[model samples]
Target: MQLDPALPALNQTVLISGPGPFVLLGVPGLVALHAWLSVPVFLLYMAALAGNALLLGRAAADKALRAPMYQLLGLLVATDLVLATSTVPKALAVLWSLSGEISFEACLAQLFVAHVAFIAESSALLAMAVDHYVAILPASALQGTPDRYSVVGIVAVAAVTHGACVMATPVALLQRLPYCGQQALPHTYCEHMGVARLACGDMRPNIWYGLATTLLSPVLT
Candidate 1:
């Protein structure tokens, strides 16, 4: 079948590919992620899955952590658990050379959770940074601030960070995405940025934000 003339111009780039295997973070090239790497990845993933599940369950059951920090931690852990579940099997399959065909819906779900966790992790780190800053201001600054004010700031930062990422991810995921081929992730984990790069449209903003958020996380702290 004849392809669109412009199709030939498409390179394996975010802008060119528009959304899947070719878009966003554009699957980290063809470099094998350690030959036969499945066993250890499976073990590690299982351990994390178990641990996060317990932590999430306990957090949900606890009444005391209704406080902001614990609340943030609980929610973040829950998201992380979801992310872990979404990614580990895929990675394991790729390593083991098993079934690698992921459906569009499943890919989207993994993409959403994993990317959400990426942002959440950054925001949590930022909150921690803010807390540290507030807790250790110069003595002169401390004099004016109330004794309990630092804790309030910490809570506020945590809540803000948590809410921001939760809100941001869905907008990016559900909104306007360029179509590509059937979804089959190259890596064991579902990478949103990687998938986005496969879109046949402008992806500069996504790339820029990904870089900006990652770079800013440490500095903000």
Candidate 2:
């Protein structure tokens, strides 16, 4: 494939091993503004962490909040915490200290956790919507009463299974490709496509799978 004239030429000589560390070029155009951007990003991270922590605490402490709906909300909050923690600290490091280096394994792990949390969160939200819908159902119109706990359990299992299976495909695909040329990724976090695009070998499978997951995840949820 021909190199883009608009972009810097890949360093053909310096090939990175599969498990080697990558340089994260966080938002290339905003390099000069990284320091300025770190402030708000830090605040947002703190807010998300604090808010989720409080919600989780409330759910755990209050007996009244032990209902199926609140259980799902707890799952959502937990996933939110996971999602934020998986990427935010690294992002803050990059923005504040320009410490953008990340190991290949670490990158893939981050990608998996972040995406899984996102999918799981969506699933929880959908489950909550279903719960709301069920709340207004007429008693006479219903068949034998559905077990609320069973519904919550099913939703939780489905969310985790879907997230694990869907997100794993791209990680597996990426692992097969040989990474040559530039190791610098132009993102704050280790996104599947962003990392895949840096690989030296054919990454069409990764691209297509990533696109498929991105488009289908919402509809599937």
Query: Which lDDT values do the candidates have, in the order given?
Result: 0.58, 0.86
lDDT measured at residue 77 in model 1 versus the true structure, 0 to 100: 70
Residue-level lDDT tens digits of model 1 in 1-221: 34555754443222333333321111356335444465577788888888887877777788875554565566567656766776776666666556566655566767666665655665655555655676567777767655543564565456456545653754465337676453444455655565665555576777776677667755754
lDDT of 2 at 64: 98
- Model 2's alpha-carbon lDDT is 0.86
TM-score of 2: 0.90
Can you give the TM-score per candidate against the true fold? 0.56, 0.90
Model 2 alpha-carbon miss at residue 27, Å: 1.7
- Tell me how many clashing residue pairs each candidate has: 16, 0
Residue ranges of candidate 1 with Cα displaced over 4 Å:
1-35, 54-76, 125-185
